[model samples]
Target: MRSTSLLVLVGSGLLLLAGCAPATGDASAGTGEAAAAAALAEGEASAAAPSPEPTAGDAEQWCADADVSARVDAALASDTEGPHNGVLVSPEEMAELGEPEAAIADQRRAWEALTDDEVAFQQCLRVRQGQSPVDPVPGSGS
Candidate 1:
């Protein structure tokens, strides 16, 4: 789903460039093709690139972020019973919780994991990769 969104976004951008391309055939000939090709190349490069390996510093920084630490602690303290435990809820479960299915699926794709250990590992790597915010769902207070 996210890949589709990205493709749509890239396609729209290419269309915009094509539409906005100067029709005069000025000094920069084939500018639209060039732009589209460059965009495609960039997208390919990004798609082909592997996820960066996480470092110890990345873990330390994630642990040290006060907001992140507080949020994690609060979530841990609040959730005591679910299989997901405020952290690794299934995308379907998230959809059931009022999040749109497609959006949740996109988020899950970005999440990139299913099991608890993988989720934890991905969370740390994601922090290193993008500093993506930790998502701590509020528990049902059971």
Candidate 2:
């Protein structure tokens, strides 16, 4: 009776393993079809939607507006006058300067009020010097 029970358990284990075995051609084909269908659906949705076009104003806005440039300049100048003279400003400083116009003045004032690391200070100055102010808008696109 014990031997019969052990045999039955082994047989059940074998059955389970066989059921978990890799599927052959037809199963693989079905999986591939499902994946293809998903891909097609995604493609169709993407195709149905039109991407927005970037305006010239958007381009100009991204290229460091006047407020950003001014703040960058101010931070760099503050760094120069402080104990951190000859230091380089970090990308964080640049980002702070590049913040929205409404926040720039306060940000610049805060930066000026505190002493920054020498490296961060110098870097900010260098970036400010390198940056060219935006050109005046043309009367029209000519």
Candidate 3:
């Protein structure tokens, strides 16, 4: 059972790291998430006074394409393993993938598929990623 669990984890991790085939589109194609991303990024610089908190939903919209990629890569590194963890695709590679927006759509779908436990785990990750602490998950003391 443990081995199977590990395999599933490893497989999922690999999928995230895998680069999608190149597509022909504008760099900003479907990325309409700058405002929210700015809020999130500003959260780091303005820890003293968080004016507009970035909602957990649609992190892409809250940040620029580069920042969105960095956030996802950071989350991946914190949760996964291997030397390649947290390593983002090169700018060239991202261009091939049709800009940063390409990954956002796929990432949103994957986020929706997360289980309860996974969601909690990611919440903890958010805390580590400089997001403010939200209410504790029910039944998860502290």
Candidate 4:
């Protein structure tokens, strides 16, 4: 999907360039053959180019990135403002349920575990919004 979107973006740019190409006084004066040859050369160059190799740690990261994105999507789908649905609470009620420090601490740890993937996914979202894609969040490994 990401690749498809990028292709569309690039295709759009190419179309804009084609539209902006200068029109010769006599466009058919060898221009057509020259353009055809140029396109052929470009196609041959593209065909001969070597494909990119994934980095060393990419094998391990592939699954982690997908899993973290799935988890985050699920969490967001079920997002809520917590059980305390915005009602005034008395000082006594507040004191009754101190701060749930342990729960907060555990949640923080869980978030930390996924922070890098989360940042990378956020950049993916930015690209889907028509912004430039960014580098994946820096991980300890790479």
Top candidate (lDDT): 1
Cα lDDT tens digits, model 1, 1-142, are 0111111112212111111111222112122244544453345334433324545666675546555555444433442322222223334333443445665665555445344444453344334323232444122121
Once superposed on the true structure, which residue ranges of model 2 sit more than 4 Å away at CA? 1-63, 79-126, 131-142
- Lowest lDDT sum, 10 consecutive residues, model 3, at 1-10
Error at 80, model 2, angstroms: 4.2
In order, candidate lDDTs are 0.35, 0.28, 0.33, 0.29
Cα lDDT of model 2 by residue, 1-142, tens digit: 0100000012111100001111121111112223533343334224433323434444344324555445445544451222222222222332332324433344334335434332233323333333212122111122
lDDT of 2 at 14: 13
**Backbone clashes in model 2:** 10
Model 4 score (lDDT): 0.29
Candidate 4 residues lying further than 4 Å off, grouped into runs, are: 1-6, 10-48, 69-142
Q: Which lDDT tens digits does candidate 4 get at residues 20-108? A: 11122211111222453344334423443322334434433432467644643443344232111111111222123232455334433
Give the clashing residue pairs of candidate 1, or none.
none
TM-score of each: 0.25, 0.17, 0.28, 0.21
Across 36-123, the per-residue lDDT of candidate 3 in tens digits comes to 4333323323343331333555243323345445544564445333323322222222233333565534444455565654544444
Off by over 4 Å in 1: 1-58, 61-113, 137-142
lDDT of candidate 2 at residue 142, scale 0 to 100:
25
Task: Report the CA-based lDDT of candidate 3 relative to the real structure.
Answer: 0.33
Worst 10 residues of 4 by lDDT: 12-21
